[model samples]
Target: MSEEELNARHAEKMKKKKAARDKILATKTIEKGLLIVHTGKGKGKSTAAFGLVFRALGNGLKVGVVQFVKGKWETGERKILEHFPEQVTMTAMGDGFTWETQDRQRDIEAAKAAWERAKAMIMDEEHQMVLLDEMNIVLRYDYLDIADVIEFLKTKPADKHVIVTGRNAKDELIELADLVTEMEMVKHPFRAGVKAQKGIEF
Candidate 1:
């Protein structure tokens, strides 16, 4: 085909694509709070949730974060979010991972304490977005009852957004979420003998 013919054909395809995209966009008119879930074996679940925290802050919204695990280590995101005290409320409640703590009862107690803070944040009308960081891990270990969590989520304000992140998310939670993203593991640096790097992993 001639170059002129190729250009014309490309333009026609793009025009059709644009029209289809616009039509789909027009159909999405519902606006309400979203229950977003990020779960899978792959990384970036909590990272993705934190990205939304920045988005909420940028939009002048207040956010509440309850870290159910990884409470011993200091993360870069936590340091940054702490600077925005007026917009962000963070509570790191876990002592550490279950294996590290080596006490089932201790883990359960920690989880219960964290859930109280999370519920408080959820009930607070001032927070526009709430992040339950690594909540799936606790749920997987049965630290808290899934049914109770779902009931609490259902009671949240209509305009409040909630994000739950961790691996092995429960099926019940996924069913209730408005948006669910499962990060499939394609490849990881740990397999290649790379330790968790600063800023990137922590």
Candidate 2:
């Protein structure tokens, strides 16, 4: 086959695959939400959560993102997310980081505010997916009520998908999660005295 013919054949194959997936999904008729937790001592929790965001967006789903304790917008994801303000909404806690905040009480207040935003998103069924960035650490730091958060999440709209990402996800959160991934840090460049790099690690 010619190159163009091969390309057309590949496109047709993909179309068939998508059609099959749609058929199976329609037959199942499972109308419910998903609770996902990404946590551990390792890394990429937020990255994993954002990957879900991209997937949801690809499927034409609206997403709400609230970043707990990430006060700034210098990261690569932030830059891309900003371009899609209509499809993706984001709010960041005003504290630079946990250790840099200095004022513990004030940091807690910031985290609480971020949680409030996430709370609203969880309750809003209009949003197909809600991403609570680093919220696990916020709850672990005692900045928000774990019980309240879990209750809100559990009662979320049937089709809503909630993603919570951070280190040290509480036991209650883990129990509530239908899907959970714990990223254990086996080895990192930081251990070898390498600093965080742009585009790749971030």
Candidate 3:
């Protein structure tokens, strides 16, 4: 086809696409807080959750974060979030990963403590968004009662958003969540013997 004909065809296709998208969007009028889950074995689960936290902060929304794991490590996100003391309430409650700690009981205790803090943030009216970092990992290990967690989350305020991030999310939690993202690992540097560098993994 001629260049002019090709350009005209593309413009016609795009016009139709925009009209269809606008029609579909018109049906989505209801606005409410969301229960979002980021799960799977991929590397960016927690990273994606932090991105949302940053977006919420940019919008002047108060955020509360409960780190269920990696509490011992000093992460770049944590350092930057700490600077926003007035808008962010963050608690790193985990001792470390279960394998590193090598104590099932200690891990359970730490998970419980973190869950308590998470519940408080979910219940608090001031916090518009709450991030439960590595929550699925604890849930996978059965460190906390899944039933109780689901029930508590069900009762969260209508206008409060909750984001949970970790691998192997439970079926029950996935069913209850309004949005669920499973990150599929296509390739990873860790598998190729590349150590996690600062500002990328942390």
For each candidate, what is the lDDT? 0.90, 0.84, 0.90
lDDT of 2 by residue, 141-193 (tens): 78898888878777778788999888889999999898999999998888889
lDDT for 55 in candidate 2 is: 82
Per-model TM-score, in order, reads: 0.94, 0.81, 0.95
Ranking by lDDT: 1, 3, 2
Q: lDDT by residue for model 3 over 90-125, one digit each (tens)?
A: 887656877788988888998898899899999988
TM-score between model 3 and native: 0.95
Tally clashing residue pairs in candidate 3. 0
Top candidate when judged by TM-score against the true structure: 3
Backbone clashes in model 2, listed as residue pairs: none
Alpha-carbon runs more than 4 Å astray in model 1: 71-74
Q: Name the 10 consecutive residues with the lowest summed lDDT in model 2.
A: 67-76
True-structure RMSD for candidate 3: 1.3
Report, for all candidates in order, the number of backbone clashes: 0, 0, 0
Best-fitting candidate, scored by lDDT: 1
lDDT of 2: 0.84
- Lowest summed-lDDT stretch of 10 residues in model 1? 70-79
